[model samples]
Target: MFSKACEYGIRAMIYIGQQSADFGRRVGLKDIAAEIDSPEAFTAKVLQGLVRQQLVTSVKGPTGGFELTPEQLRTVTLKQIVVAIDGPDILQGCALGLPQCSAKQPCPMHFQFLPIRDQLNELLRTHTIGELAGKVHDGLAFLKR
Candidate 1:
């Protein structure tokens, strides 16, 4: 299962994705943390990981923080965020942490789950960051979950 850290990290990213794209300004961590209701230090570290993964761009200054690069903005269909912060294994592993979960052996839910998982992966692979901004604007969908 995704941790609270994972949830907050995703929420932070979604806010940044919407903000930087709509407002054309890099978002500061303090502001993001406050908006998303996360601890400042913890959010800072998560933001750093996002930067390192090239999912976000960060600058150091009075008017700086993070914004998604044009390349990373609208991306996703995964139940979680990027594999860099979480791990690529989220795609292949069981959400319940089953040891034998796979197409070959399958965990308990596999009979009902593999197709949905594959669809989610395809969605993540096909979408671009810019695509998300439009969706977010249309319905305010990129909201914190």
Candidate 2:
């Protein structure tokens, strides 16, 4: 599972992509947080990581905020966003939080969780922000409130 920050970051990214595609507008942290139903402060912090990772772009002036270019929206995978916010530990950390858990000495939930994690990684890697945002744009999907 993703941390709240990671979850919010993903939703914010997808929402930004949707908004950009809809209106060709740059989005402010306030708008992004409202759309994603996250706290403004937390969303701002999460966005900083995204900006640092180059997963999203930001500006500083009065018209300043965040926006993803069309090419970026089309190519930025969930994996990149997740890694930016959550680190690669989501891919390799122990399912039960055991520091040493692994195939050699698996946790009780290890086998059950491994396949699910693998599938999640594959899905994240394959699905771009553009694809998910398209679903929102088309009314076929939504980000939870």
Candidate 3:
């Protein structure tokens, strides 16, 4: 599972991508938070990380906000967003919150959780934001009600 920040980051990215790919519009933190049903302050903080990672672009003043380039939309995977917000902990951390769990000193759930983690990593790596945005554009997926 992802942290609240990571969840907001993914939703923000997909929503921003949809705006770019479907409407050619830039998005503000308020708009994004509203669309994703996230708090504005928290969304802004999450987006700050994406901006720092160069995953999303931001600007100031009226008519200036955030947007992603076509190249970014096509290449920025959910894994990248996760790493940007949560680091590699989600993929490598112990399922039961054991800090020292590893193959040599395995926890009870370690073996059981490894394959599921691997599959999740693969799915996140392979799926780009563009694909998710395309789903939104086609009315196949949504970020909020």
Candidate 4:
């Protein structure tokens, strides 16, 4: 349901958050890409978007890399990341990809998909990167195959 970049962005965020929260360290691009099993170039681009959105911080120097502040780890929701990389439309766009789908001029599946979309939006809005990172940190969830 998410673009490849968005998928990688979410994974990168979780990994970065995990490292920052659990290990007290920032993660370099190479490490973030390796942990998430994504290409460095693509992950760098995705990270650029997150940095642009102020969802993640990027530092430059000998020991510089990427990290989320404790406040960001706790407060940055999946919805924010999704919207940052994929735009807010992903949460509200038609499931069938119809450009004009809506309540008044509903697509065939619009009414049926409304509740599901709402539930997804709620999940994204409430679920934080910290929560998912914690799951990974505790081995309750896996980011890689």
Candidate 5:
């Protein structure tokens, strides 16, 4: 349900988590884009949004571009990362866009979706970036060629 920008944004964060953990400095945008295998222009825009939300730090000098702060890494969650790029509205409401989606005025798929949405939301709420990385196990994602 997420956009390419949102997917890249998440990949960028996970990239930062692993890189910052290893390199211990502000990472360059070029490196981040390369690591995540995304286009520079698009990733730049996504990274800008993350910067505005304080989910990442940016620098302009010779040794600077972007990096995750300690607090950002520890405090940010998967939902926050997704929201920073994709927004929270979709994840918070009925996919069908019903105005009166509620327990009393339930949407057609409310019964089927309510529990699923709740679980997904809960997973996002509880899972921190580090925890998510641990589960994904850092570079173990097997994408088909």
Candidate 6:
């Protein structure tokens, strides 16, 4: 349902948030990529988009890296990250790839997919980075295979 970049972005955010909240440390791109099992270059691009959106903060120096403030970890929702990397259309796009798939012009799968899409949107809106990170930090979830 999500692009590779979006998937990686979500993983990267969760990992970064986990480190920042649990360990109280910033994460470098190389470490973030390794933890999420993504390529450094691609992760860099994804992180750049996130930084551009002000969803992630990038610092430069000997001890500098990437991190989210405590407020950001608590407030940044999955929907925000999705929209930042994949744009808002990913959540609203037609399941059948039709240009016009609204209720007025329903696609073949429109009705069947409506409930699923709404549920996904709600999940994204309600779950924050901190929540997911906590699950990982507590070993209740895994970011890697």
Clashes of 6: 0
Top lDDT: which candidate number? Answer: 4
Q: TM-score for every candidate vs. truth? A: 0.77, 0.93, 0.95, 0.97, 0.87, 0.97
Ranking by lDDT: 4, 6, 3, 2, 5, 1
After superposing candidate 1, which stretches have Cα over 4 Å from the reference? Answer: 74-80, 142-145
Candidate 3 Cα misplacement greater than 4 A, ranges: none
lDDT of 5 at 51: 88
TM-score of 1: 0.77
Least accurate 10 contiguous residues by lDDT in model 4: 88-97
User: What is candidate 3's lDDT per residue for 1-145, written digit by digit as tens?
Assistant: 7899999899999999999988888998889999999999999999998999999889888998899999999999999999999999888899998999999999999999999999999999999999999999999998987
Query: In model 5, which regions exceed 4 Å deviation?
Result: 134-145
In order, the Cα lDDT scores of the candidates are 0.72, 0.91, 0.93, 0.94, 0.78, 0.94
- Choose 4 or 6, whichever is better by lDDT: 4
Cα lDDT tens digits for candidate 5, 1-145:
7899998888888777655655677778888788778999999999999989988788899988777766676778888987778788767888577877988988889889988888888887777765554444555652212
Candidate 6: which stretches are off by over 4 Å? none
RMSD list, candidates in order: 3.0, 1.3, 1.0, 0.8, 2.3, 0.8
The clash numbers for all candidates, in the given order, read: 5, 0, 0, 0, 0, 0
lDDT for 31 in candidate 1 is 88
Candidate 5's TM-score: 0.87
Model 1 per-residue lDDT tens digits across residues 43-98: 98887876776677898888878887655764542343556567776666676678
